[model samples]
Target: MPTLLDIEAEARGCVRCPLSEGRTQVVFGVGNPNADLMFVGEAPGQQEDLKGEPFVGRAGKLLDQLVMEEMGLTRDSFYVGNVLKCRPPGNRDPKPEEIESCRPYLEKQIELIDPNVIVTLGNFATKLLLNTTQGITKVRGQTYPYGKATLVPTFHPSAALQGGGGDVISKMRADLVRAKKVLATC
Candidate 1:
C-alpha cells in the first residue's frame, strides 16, 4: 500500500483538472497519520489555499473549539482533510470533473489513515464519501459503513459562520459528540 507521502507527492504536481491551474498549492490533509477519527470537508478556501493546510480559517477554529469542548480531542488526535485538495476559483463550489479528479487522493487518504470513524462535513464531503446524492440536511445525524471505518455526516462549520444561526452550531456540536461516541466503540 502507498503511504500518504507517496500519494501527496503525486497529488502535489497533479494537473488532472482545471483546478490545478488556479490553486496556489495542494492543501493536503493534516493531523495524526494513525488517528482514530478523521474529518473530511468540501475543499480548501483562500486561507487554506495560501497556507497549504486544511481548516486553518475561522471555520477550522470553530471546528477545533467544538471538538475540544465536546470530544475532548484536538487536531493532534484526529486527521482532517478536504474532498478537493486544490481550491476552486473565487472559493466557488467544485465542479463534477474536479471532484472526479480529486476523489482518488481522498480515497487513498482513507486507506492510509485508516481512521476508525470518518465525519464528513457538509454536502459535498458527505455525498461524495457516501456515494449518495442526498443533501446533508437529510443524511446527517446518521452513520454508515465506509471501508473499515464508520462514517458520520455533519454540517460544515462554514454554515454556522455563514448565518446558519445557533441551531446549526448545536447540530454540529451534537455531531461531534456523536463522532466521539463512535470512536469510543471503535
Candidate 2:
C-alpha cells in the first residue's frame, strides 16, 4: 500500500481540476498519520491557500482552542484535511466538477489514515462523506458509521466566527465530544 507521503506527493502535482491553476500549493493534510481522529473541512480559504496549510487563520485558532479544550487533543493529535486540496478561487463553494476531480485524493487520505472517527466540519464535507443532499443544520451533532470509522457532523469553526455565536460554538463542542466518545469506545 502507498504511504500517506506518496499520496500527498502525487496530490501536490495534481492538475486534474481548475482549482490547481489558482492555488499556491496543495494543502494535502497535516497531523499524526496514525491518529484515531480526523477532521475534514470544506476547502481552503485565502489564508490556507497562501500558507499551504489548512485552518491556519482565525478559524484555525478557534478549532485549535475547541479541540484542545473540549476533546483535549491538539492539532497534532488528529489529521486535518479538506475535500479539495486546492483552494477554490475567491473561496467560493467548490463546484461539483472540482469535487469529483479531487475526491479520490481525500478518499486515499482517509484510507491511509484509517482514523477511528472522522469529524466533518461543514456542510460540504458532511454531505460528501455521508453521500447525502442534506445540510449541516439538519445533521450536525449526529454520528454515523462509514466504512471502518464513525462519522461526526459539526459546524465549521468559520461559522462560529461568522456570527454563529455561542450557540454554534456550544454545539460544535458537543459534536467534538461526541466524536471523542466514539473514539474512546473504539
Worst-scoring 10-residue span by lDDT in model 1? 177-186
Going through the candidates in the order shown, the clash numbers are 0, 0
Tens digit per residue, CA lDDT, model 2, 104-152: 9999999999999999999999999999999999988678998999999
Q: What C-alpha lDDT do the candidate models reach, one value each?
A: 0.94, 0.92
Q: Give the runs in model 1 whose Cα sits over 4 Å from its true position.
A: none
Weakest ten-residue segment in model 2 by summed lDDT: 137-146
Error of 1 at 56 (Å): 0.3
For model 1, how does the per-residue alpha-carbon lDDT over 95-170 read when each residue is reduced to its tens digit?
9889999999999999999999999999999999999999999998878999889999999999999999799999
Angstrom error of the Cα, residue 82, model 1: value is: 0.3
RMSD of each: 0.6, 0.8
